[model samples]
Target: MSISGLNTLKKGQHYTAKELDSFISTTDAVLLSNNENQLFTDPEREYKVTHELDGFFEHSEEDAEKHFREKKAYVVEKA
Candidate 1:
């Protein structure tokens, strides 16, 4: 989510945590996301990288992709 994108969530409708999470699933950035449980980020793509693979750490985009191809790590991004 972008700075202004946060407003999309706050524009007049009060949302519950579960309802907000549904909205957060479609957002484009992490920091502006409504999901507080999302604390991990890939250093390479910043907002585009939502979750880290279990038991895996990434320091670079290339490394992340490599692991992804090998099914060692996976990421979550909205379509």
Candidate 2:
């Protein structure tokens, strides 16, 4: 998706599965790897993050940054 403004989802906040899915879908990302990873079509990229219980999708540390920056994913940092 081509969001014109800054993101409304805070930097570190948890969101429900439905909410997360909606954001991903609206952004034109295809849920992959059993909803763990997402494939972005426009850029022809795939993002996979390690899954956390309270987070939208599993994000690995290696890929988290890219995923967050590209998809504007809501990432709730662990305490």
Candidate 3:
């Protein structure tokens, strides 16, 4: 029930709304499991924006149809 890995859910954890809000807003974007093992990063450190994309494609059927109707091309450059 965790969204963006900030424990933004309290389905059974009994977390207060304010507590969840604080964690979601202030805590770093990192994953923490029940085993207390930190994955993908050091919990105390901030991560850098390693990459970015200019645009993305419409994945939904309706959205893709609309995109094609509008004559928008979903282009992907070859690496």
Candidate 4:
């Protein structure tokens, strides 16, 4: 399937189950999870971490660093 088709699925537009299955089968990169004996696919991309932000507010020092890194990586990947 084309990237445009994949984009459509990510947006939650109406599509037949068969179409979704076909697209999933053909994609090189896909997300999947095992649930209750069934394999489910995640259409959204995964997140990653890569930076440090404020070290004194919102969350504990550890958590704040983690979140900042994650958001930075997410932004970079989207770019």
Model 2: per-residue Cα lDDT over 1-79, one tens digit each:
3333323443334444444445555553333234333322223232233332222444578755533324333333222
Let me know the TM-score candidate 2 reaches against the reference structure.
Answer: 0.29
TM-scores of all candidate predictions against the true structure: 0.26, 0.29, 0.23, 0.27
Give the per-residue lDDT of model 3 (tens digit) for 1-75: 233455223222333233333454754332223323332233333222222233333456654553312221111
Lowest lDDT 10-residue stretch of candidate 4: 70-79
lDDT-superior candidate, 1 or 4: 1
Candidate with better lDDT, 2 vs 3: 2
Sorted by TM-score (best first), the order is 2, 4, 1, 3
Q: Rate the local accuracy (lDDT) of all candidates.
A: 0.35, 0.37, 0.32, 0.31
Better of 3 and 4 by TM-score: 4
Candidate 3: give its CA RMSD in angstroms.
14.6
Which numbered prediction scores highest in TM-score against the true structure?
A: 2
Model 4 Cα shift for residue 34 (angstroms)? 10
- The number of the candidate with the highest lDDT is 2
Model 1, 42-63: lDDT tens per residue?
Answer: 2222223344333343256645
Error of 3 at 5 (Å): 25
Candidate 4 TM-score, C-alpha based: 0.27
Q: Candidate 4 lDDT, tens digit per residue, 1-79?
A: 2333452233323333344445556644332222322322333432221222222223556555433222211011110
Clashes of 2: 8
Worst 10 residues of 1 by lDDT: 66-75
